[model samples]
Target: MLCIGFDVGGTNARGCLMEFTDATAPPRQLAEVKERIRDTRAPSQVAAVMADIATRLVEQEGVDPAQIESAGVGIAGQLDKTGNTVVGAPNLGWTNVPFKSVLVESLAGAGFTPPVRIVNDLAANVWGEFCVGAARGHQDVLAVYVGTGVGGGVIAAGKLYGGHGGKAGEIGHSKVVPHGAPCGCGQRGCVEAYVGGRRLEERLTQDYRAGRSLGLRPYLPVELRDVDHMHMDAIIRPDVADAAAAAGELYADGLWSYVADLLAMAIANGAMVLNPGLILLGGGVLRNTKELSRRVVERIPSYILRAAADDIEIRFGELGDDAGVYGAALLARG
Candidate 1:
């Protein structure tokens, strides 16, 4: 049977098509595609986008619709235990939508009537790693992926552990400070609010404007406060060589330490509560900035109980950008 997996996030939707002949056979990847949804908030629009993706896969690969058996979709927000209702995805501007049914209907119209199953994106990630990626063979595991925002999942006693309402493992939403940076979830003090890529960029930009002394050329406005102008040009004093070099290191260290501490706290809390056998970390932010990941890894043990934290393994996720897709596909197989 053919199965499909879709990973829908605030910025993009990625899908993969698979063919499996038997329960023991390794899945054959038939097609992979990535698309951007123009109207993420509308379930109908999202369904249409997914429908198109499925149709293209079947057609391009010369597969009959009847061969498709099931589909699993992962999303970056909360869902009911049944995984059919979108409780609330502030980033997608969606709330209480019948996502699974809507998507099934659209796919049916496109010559595919496969059953659709959905789960949180982070859950998808942890499952992928646990089954075939870095955390493979591990029964108790935790995964936190840092991207445009943060999302994570936990596995306990050999099963994916979603709390009663399926909103467990939301480490990103935990408040890091009383009234810190605002998060995309419309709240403040979240770990994501502090270290998310976009938020980090915005914070650094604001810091430079506020005179934190980074090495980048300063932007000065003639009419703006704390800005000076000379004739037609606005000028700021150039930082001395040593000061500029030191400032650059200071700026970077300042951001990394803050991010590391925030992650450490979240990891420690999750570890103390779950005591997973392994912790898998991944995503664009972690992939690109290795040292940040290193810093967090180094700082995590300090945040948790001595014995519990000592033995648990911490490793980067191995699936790269395909984690959600692989996990979703695994879910579809079930």
Candidate 2:
């Protein structure tokens, strides 16, 4: 059987075609395609881009569209209980959008129809890691991804736990400070407010404009020095990490270190509560900065309960950028 999976984000939508037999066996990737999202305001537009990516993958693989038995979408957003509607996606500027329906319509229009499963992107990532990546043998796992924003997913007792509202693993929104930095979610002091890539860029921009000397400023483009906000073309988390890494001693006391500390704190708090056997961290930030993971690991024991910290194995995700797509496809196959 064949399954199609998609990982849609604010910047791009990636889709993959995989062949799978059952849940026990791993899926084999046949083809993958990615499309940059030009317009994210409309759900239909993004759905269309995903549909096109799916179509292109099938074509690239020379597989019959009819061979696809199921489809899965890992999207960045808060989903309703049914998982059909995106309650809100701050990065995409979406509110109460029937994303699954729009995607289904778009796929149908593209001459493809398959039962689609919609899940939070982090959930898909965790599932991927659980099935075939770093957490392969772990029954209880917590997966956190720090990119444009921070997101988390949990697998408890060998099953995905969605909680009463199907939003169980939103560790990003966990409050870190009272009345601190503002988050895109319209809240204050969220872990994401301090560590998310977008938030970090915003903070850097603010600090630069305020005449605060930053180690990262020299590494940034000259034009960004006078900019009010860091645009897409400006320096990102990976660039910032590189700059910090280059400045040996500064890496320890720089903004990236603070970001790592807060993220570690959030992860520790989550570990104390969930007590998962494995804690897998990934996403653009962790992937780009290897030192951040070590820093986070070093701080975990201090913040987490001793018992919880003792048994937990913290590691970076193995699947890199393809975790979501692989997980989504396997989940759809099941």
Candidate 3:
């Protein structure tokens, strides 16, 4: 069977063509393409870009369009209960967009017609991990991805668990403190406010501006140090995970350690409620800073209940950036 998978984010859209026969085995990648999203606010435009990428993949691989059985997209946004509409995508500046319909129309225009599935990006990542990555053998799993923002997904009793509103596993917004740091979600004390890559960058920038001395400062570019205002491009952006990793080499006991401790506490709290058998942590932050995950692993046992902590296993994801694409393809197979 041939499947197409896409992982659409705020900045880029990535698609892959895969061939698979067995549900348990990893799919074989035939072709892949990526494109920058010129404008996130227009759902049709983004969908058309993805369709173009898919078309290119098929043409690159010399595959018959009729052979494509299904396609899936893992997108960063709040999806409606049916998963056909994007209720809101803060990064994409979208609301109540019929993304699946737009994608279908775009694909049809590109001469490829197949059943399409849309899911939360984190859910796809977790599904990918559960199916063929770190959590493959675990029946109950929890996955936390710490990128520009923190997000999570859950698998319960060997099935993906979408809560009553089909938006479970929003661990980032779960409050860890009362009236503490502010989050982009308009909430105070969210876990994301403490450990998310964007939040961390903001905090670091603030510290630098206030002359509070950040370990991340020395590793930053000379131009970044002289900036008087907060600018995403001028500052050490979260997408550049290597800067955080570099700072950690000499300052393991600084702000990064504190962030790791807070993240571990959040994961431990999650474990207490979900009792998941396995926990998988990924995303740009954790992937680049090995010490961060190490600190999280070391501290989780201290926060979680003894009984629950004893049986839980934690590991980083194995698929790296490809988890979403792989998971989407496997999900389409269903």
Best by lDDT: 3
In candidate 2, which residue ranges exceed 4 Å CA deviation? 21-26, 208-211, 214-257
Over 194-243, each residue of candidate 3 has an lDDT whose tens digit, in order, gives 88888877765665556554545555676665555334245455433345
Clashes per candidate (backbone, < 3 Å)? 0, 0, 0
Q: Locate the minimum summed-lDDT window of 10 residues in model 3.
A: 232-241
TM-score of each: 0.85, 0.86, 0.90
Model 2: lDDT equals 0.80
TM-score of 2: 0.86
lDDT by residue (tens digit), candidate 1, 1-334: 6888899987777788887554433467889887897556478988888888888888889888778888888897789988889997766888898788888889889988767789998898888777777887788998888877887898988788998878888888888888887787788989988877667656655666565643333333325433422222322321221223334566656667777899878877888888988988887777767667777899888988888987899999877767677778778767
Judged by TM-score, which candidate is best? Answer: 3
**Of 1 and 3, which scores higher on TM-score?**
3
| Model 1, global lDDT | 0.76
- TM for candidate 3 is 0.90
In model 3, which regions exceed 4 Å deviation? 214-234, 237-252
Off by over 4 Å in 1: 20-27, 39-41, 216-248
Cα-based RMSD of the predictions, in order? 5.5, 3.5, 3.1
Clash pairs, candidate 2, are none
